[model samples]
Target chain A: MASNIPEKYKTLIKNNKRIDGRTLDELRPVKIKVGVIPSADGSAYIEIGNTKVLAAVHGPKEMFPRHMINEDRAVLNVRYAMLPFSTSERVRPGPSRRSNEISKVTRHALESVIFLEEYPGMGIDLTLDIIQADAGTRATAITAASVALAHAGIPMKGLVAATAIGKINDRLAVDLNGPEDNFGQTDMPIAMISTNKNITLLQMDGDFSKEEFKTALSMAKKAIEPLFEAQRAALQKYYK
Target chain B: MTLLYQNMQYIRNNIAKNREDGRTSEQFRDITIETGIIGRAEGSARVKIGDTEIIAGVKMEIGTPFPDSPGEGIIMVNSEFSALASPDFENGPPREDSIELSRVVDRGIRESKTVDVEKLCIEKGSKVWMVFVDITIVNHDGNLIDAAGIGAITALLTAQIPTINEDGTLNREEFVGSLPIKEIPVPITSGLINNTIITDMTKDETECSDAIFTVTTIENENYCAMQKAGPSEMTEKQMLDIANIAQKESKKIRSAIKATVKKHKI
Candidate 1:
C-alpha cells in the first residue's frame, strides 16, 4: 500500500501500546454535546480525539423538486463535507470524490434506523460537517448524526454508533489515528444500531485474513458500546 | 403496481424453498464471460449474470505517478450506468450508486494487490503505465457489483502492456508483455429479503430486498473488501454466515474465470 507517512512514524505499536499511548482496542477521549445549533431542528457536536464533527437535521418538511417526493415514505437526504480548514491542507470547497463516497455510505449507515415511513410526502435533510479531522471522520460524523436525529425528535429504532478498526503492525487495534490510518495495513469502518446490535454499515480496505477479519468485527462491536452510551447520555442530558 | 406487488409477495412467500428462478437461498444465477470483445481497447470482457450484463474494458496510458507512490503505477476503476441499461438510470453525471460500485470493485482489486503496480513503473518517479478499467452496464438486472468485479479482473488478467517507442512515446500498436497479476479477487453479493439471505438476486428480488452485502475474497478464502448497503440492518451472525458463503462462492467463480481465460488462450 502507498502511504505518505514520514519514515520515522512507520512504527505504530510498541509493547502493545500505540503511538498515542492507548492500548490496542482502546478509544480516544470522546465528548458529546447535543443541541449545539439552535437554528437547526436538531443538532449535535462530537469530538473523538482531535477530530471534531457537527451534525444538524432539518425537516420532515415539504420536499421540493416534485420528482424526488416519496408518497410512501419520507426521503432522507444526507450531505457530508469536510470544511476547507478541517485538515492541514485546505480541501477545496464543494464535494470531492472522497466526500461524495463518504456521504453515500453515511446515508446508508443511518437510513436503516430512521422511521422514514411515518412521514409520507416529506423530506429529512441531515448534514454532517467535519470541523477538524485526524482520522475516522466518517465514524465520528455518524455517531454525531445519530444523536442529532434523536435530538430532532425523529423516531428511530435505535441510535447508531460507529468506529474504525484496523491492523497496525500485525496487531488488531481500534480507533486508528491519522498516522495509524495511513501507515497501517488495513482499516475497516463499521456502524451498528445500539438497541439490537444490528450492523447497518460496514466497509473495509486493505488485506485481512479470515481470522483477522473475524477478530476485527468483534473488536468493532466492542468499541461501539461506549459510543452508544455516550449518545444516550447526551440525549438524556439534553432532555434533563 | 398490483402485478409488481404480487410478484414480490410470491418471492417472499417462497424464499425459504426456491426463488422464482429456481435458485436456492445461497445459489447464484448462471454466469457467462466473454473476453477480448472490444477490438479498440487493450483488453475487454463482457460478463453476464442471469439478465445482468456488463462490459469491462482496459485502456493503458502513459501518466505521471502520484507524489506519494511515484515508484508505482496507478489503477483506476470507473463505471457508467447508461440510461439504456435500466429505466431508473438517467443520462447525467455518475450517481452515488455507480460511484459506490466502482469504488467497491476498486477496493477489492487494489486491496488484494491483484495487479503488481510496481512493475509498470518506467522511470521510477517520472512516468509509468496507468491502467484504467472502465465498466459499462449494458443491462441491469441485479448483482451488478459482483458481475462488474469479475469483468474487471478478467479484463485486467488478459490486458497487454503497450510498448514504448524509441523517443519516449507510447507505442499503442505494439505489446511488450501481459500485465502482471499477483492474485484473483472475486466479489459475491447477497441480498436480505424477509430475513432470508439470498445470493444473485434478480431485479425484482433486489427491489424487494431490505438490504444487501457484497463481500470480496481472494484465493486463500480470506476477505479483502466488503460493503453493506441499503436501508436495513443485519445481525453479526448473519454477516458472518454471509462472509462464509462469499468465501465458498468466490472459489467457484475464480475457477470459472480461469477456465474461460484458458479456453480463450489469453
Candidate 2:
C-alpha cells in the first residue's frame, strides 16, 4: 500500500508514549489570558502546545446594511484566519476555503450560548487569528473566543470548550499535536458546553469504527474539562 | 403571522403522526441517481432526494502535486449555490454556506480514500492527475449536503481516466480503464425539529429545525466523516441517536447506488 506517512518519524506512538512524550490522553500545556487587547471591546489570547490564537469580540451594536438584520435575534459574524507566517510554509494572507469553513463552524459553536435575542436587530462580530499553528487550531480558536466573549461581559448560558481526538498507530489519543494530526488515521475536532455536556460543534475526518467513534466522543468529553477550567480561571482572573 | 403559526402547527402535527410526506421519523425521501448526464464532462451525475436536486461533474487535468504529498494526486471540490436554485441565493462569489457544503462533501470522499490517488501520480513529483468535482445545486428543497455528496461520489465512480501520449500530448477521445475507486461513502443528514429527530428533512422542516447533523458511512458501517451544524446544542444522547440513524440509512442508500451503477454497466 502506498503510504502518505512522513519519513521524518518512524512511528507516532512507542511504549504507550507519544512522540511529544505525553501519555495517550494527556493534553498539552494550555495558557489562557483575557483582556489582551485594549482597543477592542474584548479580547483574549491562548496557546495550546505550539498553536497560539487571539480572539476579539467587536459588538452587539447596530446591524449594518439593514437587510442582514434579524428582528427576532441578533446575527453573528465570525472570521477565522491564519497569519502568513503561522505555519512552516507561509500561508497566503486572505480568507481560504478552510478558513471559511472554520469560521462558520466556530460561529455555530458559540451561537447556542450567547443570548442573541436580547439584542434584536443587532450584530456581534468575532475574529480569531492564528498566530502559530501545530494542530488543533480550530479547537484552540474556539476556546479563546469563548473566553473573549465572556470577558466582554456578554451574557452566555455557559462556556464552550473544544479539543481534537485522534487515532495514531492503532491507538486512540486526545489533543493530537502536529505530527500526529498529519500522519494519524483520524482527526475529530469537537466543541462542547461543559455545564450540561451538550455538544455544540463536531467535525471529523478519517477512518473510525463505530466503537472507536464512541470512545473518541467520551475522550473528548474528558479532554474538555481542563479546557473549561482554564477558561473559567482566565475570566475569573481578569475580573478579579 | 397567523399563517406562519398555522403552518408550523401543521408540521408539528405531521411529525407527531408521520412526516408531512407520510414517511416515518427515520425514513429517507425517495432517491434518484442518473449518471453521465453531462456528456462533455469527464464524468457527471445528477442526484435527487425528493425535491432536492444536485448535479456534480468531474474534470481531470495534469498538474503538479502539492509539496507535502508529491507522490499522491489531488482532489478539489467546489460548490455553487446559483440564484436559480433558491430565492435566497444571490449572484456573487461563493458564500460561506456553499464553501461549508463543498468541504463537508470533500471530507467524506477524501477521508474514505474513495479514489486511489497514488495511482494517478504520473511521476514522482513532476506531474499528477488533479481531479476536480464541481457540485451545483439545481433545486433546494432540503438536505442539499446529502444530495450533493451522493452526486459527487456517483460521478467519481463512473469516471474514466484519459490516456496521455508519451510526448505529453492529450488524447481525450481514447481512454484507459476506469478511475481507481476503493470505497464508496454515503452521507446521511438528520435534523432536530421541536425535539423530534427527523431524517430527510424538507425545506419547510429544515427552516424550523433547531439543529442538523450529518454522518458519512462507508462499507462495514464505519464512519469516515461527520459534521454537526445549526445553532442549537445537542446532548450526547441525541448525537449518538442521530449517528445510529445515519448508519442504518446509509446502508440502504449504498445498495441503491451500487444497483444503479451496475445497471449502467460502469
Score residue B44 of candidate 2 by CA lDDT. 89
Range of the 10 consecutive residues with the lowest summed lDDT in candidate 1 chain B: B1-10
Structural similarity to truth (TM-score) of each candidate: 0.97, 0.96
Docking class of 1: medium
Report per-candidate DockQ.
0.75, 0.75
Off by over 4 Å in 1: A3-5, B1-3
Reference contact recovery of candidate 2: 0.85
Q: TM-score of A-chain in each prediction?
A: 0.97, 0.97
Q: Listing every candidate in turn, what is its Cα RMSD in Å to the true structure after a full C-alpha superposition? A: 1.7, 1.9
DockQ of 1: 0.75
lDDT score of residue A6 within candidate 1: 78
Candidate 2 C-alpha lDDT tens digits along A126-171? 9999999999999999999999988887889999989999988878
